[model samples]
Target: MTYPHDPIPDLSADRAELFAAAAAEYDRYRPGVPPEAAELLAETLRDLPDPTLLDLGTSTGQVPKALLKALPSLDYIEGVDLSQQMLDQARAALTPVLGGCTLSLVQTSAELYKPLAPLPEEEWWTPDLITCCRAYHWMSGPDVLARTHRIAAPQASLAIMGDGSLWMHEADWTRALRDLVQQFLGAGRRAGALGDCPKPVRPFQEELADSAWSDVAEHRFPVTRSWSPESVLGYLRTTSFAGADLFAERHAAFEEEARALLDNLADGGPLLEETAFTVLLARRRAGAR
Candidate 1:
């Protein structure tokens, strides 16, 4: 399918290095894909006798780890990302759980990645399932989706999913936290060194509708997450909008004030964030590829 829109000018804002400094903290604090989302992905692969997975923006291997738990029969797994630090974390976290499964972690952006040619007699390396969890917003949708269609198996499935970040949650505590971050970093949302958050792209559903993977289904799982003040702080440290690096010398002060605010807000209890984890599952019609 030819995209009607002009080629997007790579609005991801220097993402290759955006998460480099916070990768370890990101792995420690970022939540994994919800279990129901994994089950939904697993359902799509049930018919493939020996499925392989290609995970785009596979930060810390969270999505693969969740899916592996749901579908141990998967034969091969490949993770693509821009940060080597994140891939290193993903390798460490995913290696032990992948009993007998072949794993490849590549350091590259999703749009430029190409699978290695399979060995003689082996089917060409085409993933049966492609997933981009919590990271698709950092990519050029039309370019990535077009590239994905070329690399995926004839009947492959694509899942783009994420829950909004803590920065956007409506809880009173989160609002206070956002206010504190703004005080330190100014009003514009930070996108690493870029200093301004990228504008929101068209919705993923609309992007999918324009691509070859136009047969789409959406599933949303309502999740209630509990966070202590410390966990919330750790998660904040991994975000571009509020990470310590963005705060310069004022990071310590921000954390101190945030801790006090969260303590008062929690009143000796967990801070709760009620969110809906949304998954956009897409595929092409038979022979449409």
Candidate 2:
């Protein structure tokens, strides 16, 4: 999808490497539990029987980890991600959560993975539910949604959840961080090293409606996740904008400065903050329309 900001150089390979290097530090960077995400997962799976599920952009398998805890009878749960390192980490962490359930991790870009047609009379492993958590924006417009519809079974559901104003809670920090990002990008940094800017919900909502899906609905839920200063900095480091190659010479210095700023802004001994998540849910048309 075309981004409003200046186009950054494509550094997908570099970003992958950076994430791999910091994979082990993921939990430390953003340790706060995504309660809202967990709730949505549970809510979506509450009524559905044992069904095949596909999770796109399943970084560290956070969404699936929570869902498995709530629904243990899932026939199969598959996670797809572009970063091998992130997938590796997810597999390790999700093994216990996936006890007795079939779990598979495919290292691939969510936009590129094609879902095969379900076998005749087989309704269970047909991917009745598909979810994209905090990672749908990275997909390229209608193509992603269209591809999703192709793989989903009739009456299947697709949910796209993201922390809409995730970083906007702290206005001061948000503005400062944006400036820092622009400055870094202006210096001819790699494109993939740049984190994606916030996207409005209307476009994606419209895309889902135009795709092979019906009953599209958009909903917003209030949610909060707390993180310490160091953890927050670690989270920032995991972003493409803060990848190793983007700020090879200054990554350490930037982290130091960020830690200091966050430390100064802490409240009640922790850098706690509340944010909201927006979820868009749509059901696949009963028949290919």
Candidate 3:
């Protein structure tokens, strides 16, 4: 499960600081999967025997929290993330809920850690349920799918979900905000310059379809979360475009405009929008040799 390419981003030092500063806000605005993701995850896990779960790119450990809450009998849960700051936040948030369950945190790139090569073989931690929520796009397509196939135990279930419709659902406002940033920062400084846009899941779907997995399933969940204007602005602050250099000069004005936009909306109580998400659930062939 080695990565074919390095997975680290070429983020500036200042951008790294910006990410650390925004860690709390990122957790605040980061929506939990709202019943649908939790339900689907629960259903998928039900088919498996008692499982050791691995949550990849488990930012703030939110999805695992939900999963464990739904399936309290889960014996072991591990969350891996690349960001130390984010992992710290997750540890703090999950500490209270770790009662009677084994919770382990690992800070590493998902690509490099897949198949969890660094783990001791004697640890007896083979995962029967592996779930990645909202973090799959950070992975190169082939790397993630192939890695999933490798690490997962035979007949293990993998569920990958992303908040793909975040911007697409709010296209008009998002475009306006992007245009404004571009206007001030110029064309090449466009937001999401690092290809942070929601990646289509088709490639991974096709990969799984052609792979040896059986009972493959893919489905879309329509979901929504409400956000205050301030919260939404805080969420934007966590994006790559809002690095310290960009945030210092523009964040205040951006907040002002975001508040105004929220006020102008019909409800006038901030913004509520629907988002679409795709969940790919598949099981490795049982007893494949």
Name the candidate that leads on TM-score. Answer: 1
Residue-pair clashes per prediction, in order, are 0, 3, 0
Query: 1-289 in candidate 3: lDDT tens per residue?
Result: 2222222454233322434566777788777766677777777667665657888888788887888777776767778776667777878887788667777776666666644344555564578788888776666656666676777776578887776533445555566666655665565532333433454566667766666554578878887667666666667676655443464677677667656765565256646667777888877665542
Please write out the lDDT profile of model 1 over residues 8-101, one tens digit for every residue.
3452436767887888999889988889999999998877888899999998999889989999988889998887778888889988999978
lDDT of each: 0.86, 0.67, 0.66
- The sequence of per-residue lDDT tens digits that candidate 2 reaches over residues 168-285 is 4566655565556566555332334444544456677777778776577777776656667766677766665565556678777777776776777674475545666677788865
Estimate TM-scores for all models: 0.93, 0.80, 0.80
Candidate order by TM-score, decreasing, is: 1, 2, 3
Ranking by lDDT: 1, 2, 3
Q: What C-alpha lDDT, on a 0 to 100 scale, does residue 250 get in candidate 2?
A: 79
Alpha carbon lDDT at 194, candidate 1 = 71
